[model samples]
Target: MSSAPGADAAPGSNPIPAPSATTPTTAIKRQTFSSLKVRNYRLFATGAVVSNTGTWMSRIAQDWLVLSLTGSSTAVGITTAMQFLPMLLFGLYGGVIADRYPKRKLLMLTQSTMGVLGLALAALTLTGQVQVWHVYAIAFLLGMVTVVDNPTRQSFVVEMVGPKDVRNAVSLNSANFQTARLVGPAVAGVLISAVGSGWAFLFNGLSFGAPLIGLMLMRPSELYEVERTPRGKGQLREGLRYVAGRPELIWPIVLVGFIGTFGFNFPIWLSAFAHSIYHAGASTYGMFNTAMAVGSVIGALLAARRATTRMRLLLGSAMIFGVLEMFAAISPSLWLFVGLLVVIGMFGITVNTTANSSVQLGTDPVMRGRVMSLFMMVFVGGTPLGGPLVGWVTDTFGPRIGFLSGGLVSAGSALVIAAVLVKAGGLRVRVDLRGRRVRFVEREPAGERERESVVAGVG
Candidate 1:
């Protein structure tokens, strides 16, 4: 399962420590914003914020376009499916590619390609030549590019700030993404209402420049370079074998797969709720997304404060999030639903951020790209399966049924995985009036030293 030695740090380890007293507290203790202290990361994040917002804007407009052109929620789901289906197929290969190349250069290439595609879509829509097929084709192309971009970007965070700051960087990155989620959809909705969708697409296309510039401006000498995986046959198989052997790594991914497949089917749920159940227009749809972003930003902020990722916290958040999502599904009023979305969004981010940091911290640096790809493959790639299933459920049984299914699966999967890990990790869960507690005991079959699992806060 091991790769060559002298590779970068494993994502799963807390290799980097807090700066000594000689270092300024302000530089280190900005909570989630601490990662912003890195000059490269700051520039990267600022540009990413701009680009991410535009990306969200395009997503809203694209889904809206599909709905408008076909008047079918299933068609909208197909568009979502098109974007992630490539990940299901090529994500692992992309991970291998990430390990082989410098992430910054790879990101520049991918970002430029995506921008060109966005501009093409915008041109078609503005020229009145846009159709559902065009949207589908563009989405498929974007997904193809993202197969490489997503993993490279995920693993690239380590190079920007090294492993010690990587957790903060990951949280801040999520926070940045959520911030865009807050702004993008709302603005996209208004833009769609006031003018049309073409401008939104154009904006997203142009937004890629921010990131490209950031990449170009980075001080490459300051980067924390790691050992790149040498190109060879059988390396891909070795990557898979690496993850298959680690329970700590495998469980969280399994948790993410079930959760992502069922829990993160937000596109289908939001679209169905906005268009079908509520008859809400684009503005209302944007409001739903923004409300969720509010929670997500808060969740990301909270996650940033922690130094360690815990398995218990990851599982617990999923359990609660599943329940809340179900309740949000059956909300009687739109306002109440929006409010619930805020909380659900918060819990959802906790699960996601924790899982990401945990897996990265646990894996060796050399294997970061491949393991993260596997992690994401389960987390985001599950969409190919879930998107259509949820769409079918929304179309057939109703949107509420779709929500209930996702919630049940997410909650059930977490419970099953947790139950298994209680034995595998040599832990006991005690039930009492004081609530549930998981205590680390000695590994079974022989007495051994207690392995302290560093966690942020007990769930």
Candidate 2:
């Protein structure tokens, strides 16, 4: 259970061993930072941390800017919608572009466009000439760019360190994003309080420079080469068929869709909670986000240390997220509610990072772009469609019901999926009487069904 089949091994070799808790100090010395041993991945991670921090800052600033500009919750929802709508419409096509083009060069172009877009928004907002329409226009444009940029960036990770290090790389990528989430919002809050939202936007624009430069500086020879597929009859259909044929690919996408639509609409709920439930201002909202970011950072770090790619942990964590959200929804005190959010955020990122890593690690190298795009589409594209409904629920029924609805739906979906996976795989679930640990095992038809539990662990 510790070492997943063929995970973290040289191609065609045995899997790397899971480090033992009782191993001597001398034994530990031989282990390496498998992914970072590659120079290109190190550079990419470093640059991404710098850029991702800026992205988070902009997110916080953008939300605050919209809230300040119009005190209505609906405006914030609209801003979120404009940014995610294109992903719903064009995400699959973005996969096609990633498959057919040179991802590095495509990324360079996309990054530059993003910087320009961010700077344009900053200039507009700073001069006091910005209207709601301008924010909408900018959000839509940014979404359009991300439609292509997202898949390209996702596909680019595999090439950075290759398949052997892919799981670690993906976990580290989540860590980087979460780390940025922690810094960016705190910085944005102070900047917005002092000068205006414009400087936060400007910093985001500048953040693009790091990744752009990192892409340029990569040695082409060290990168993994994904062959470009020629345009053919039914190419996109082929990608769909490819996914349809694989349960490993299809189920994770379904799980993420459910989570994204319900569990992931945090900002919508957070904004309402801060203003209505907590009776706090912009700074309080920032603190709420920062707390979530703190939890996310911890989740990402824990995921980075994982040696297995099993889906059970992810599914269970998602269940925990739903349960915690429900706890937050009914809490009477602001401190208790914020504390619940911290736990919710922790498990939320754990579920997301685990699902993402599983899907990517399970995929074929040639098909990764298409697969990941499909994954991203379901995981992110569903947001725009769901956000308005969530927003309306928050605005109408109130924040508690909105949170309750999402939490219940998420937990229900996960329970259903867990049952299906268990039945299909003929899995046995075992519980130890003395501890909180549970073990699951896959059983052959001829095997003793009651004794099939493969391993045990603390839940």
Candidate 3:
């Protein structure tokens, strides 16, 4: 039954009352932590913090274990590459799986698999039955899980926090990860010195328990439901087609691939840089990673304070990152090298966090999983394609040249992308002084629309 209209309503119409102040304003916010206002997000964040710390611990231990066994810089490179190779080969498919499955449920399966793998690796290591090949096998297996886990985690954040709090959530996620990086290596260093690398793996296996529990405890009613799209013909090809059409999407992927392939294989470079250049031991390697983590934490905190996202800042910062990587490569002292790494770490996170947020914000909902998978592919998966080459270069020409080469290539690639984006998008880079930021402004040349039409016809 329609009630009589109030002054706010038209004739024969019912007017809805304005929501009271007590009613939350859920419509306007656009950051990631807004989901934390919901109980479920808080629980998940808490659990993830615990699990991520342990995961970092395992990463440190794994690298150390490989170095201890083979004592070859190239072996560490191989280990790192193996762990990321599956993402190169299968990340796109994993994204397709993510879009089709219930994300939370899929995460549970992947997390459990991770736990079992960690335990098996630990047992083998502790029993003195593990070989270098065994480590490679386990690392490869874990990489496969990560191929799925990474995209799922990125998309899941959107669901947990909704759109409003996405930026904050993304920053906080980086904070959590870097925080783990900060503590993980320090703890692994002490533990490895005290007991063995096996215990570190065992602890990591146990750490998965928190996230597993959090998953089990989530209430079904609280879940954010995204419509499941039917699988279409050429789904993967379609995803590629969509990305190919967008300059913002395609350029960033290209930039990330270049940086990731050339610049960010620090794990492989770290051991060599430490031993060959710095003449340091395992403890020094631990110290180097810890210092980088400290800088990363600082970057994460700074990113958390931003009220808005800026893509130009990301591009400019990426340019600086290349400069810093070059500096880190040629530093004379170990102390200077580690200090340089801190600056490098800071900018690295800035570049990564900005790129990640840009990719997520830029994609269509149905296509998001695939887009993110492609992003992960370029950012992490592409590491292997260049990892061994970087190692061989380091081993052959000296670690300094390896660093120099990576820096030059990264900077060159970024500049090329910037030029392409400027021309393709008709984008003029501008600084907004009042906003204390930089942005790209779209400028259309005379008859640009008609020109586009002519070009379209020609194509």
Residue range with the least summed lDDT across 10 consecutive positions in model 1 = 16-25
lDDT of 1: 0.83
Q: lDDT by residue for model 1 over 1-459, one digit each (tens)?
A: 333322233444223332221222244444667778888888899999999999999999998888889887788788888999899999899999998877888898999999999999999999999999999999989999998998899988877787777778899999999999999999999999998999999999999999999988887666675667888898779998998887667878888999988789887889889988999888888999999999999999999987666677888899999999889888999899999999999999999888888777777767788988888887888888888888888889988888888998898898888777665555655444465565444343456655543222222
TM-score of each: 0.90, 0.89, 0.86
Ranking by lDDT: 1, 2, 3
Better of 2 and 3 by TM-score: 2
> Candidate 2: which pairs clash?
none
Taking the tens digit of each residue's C-alpha lDDT, what string does model 3 give over 38-138?
A: 66667777888888888888888888888889877678789889999999999998888776667788888999999999999999989989899998999
Models sorted by TM-score, best on top: 1, 2, 3
lDDT scores for all predictions?
0.83, 0.77, 0.76
Q: Can you give the lDDT of residue 448 in candidate 3?
A: 57
Off by over 4 Å in 2: 1-33, 426-428, 434-436, 441-459
- Model 3 spans with C-alpha error above 4 angstroms: 1-35, 425-459
> lDDT, candidate 2, residue 183?
81
User: Against the true structure, whose lDDT is highest?
Assistant: 1
RMSD of each: 5.3, 6.2, 8.4
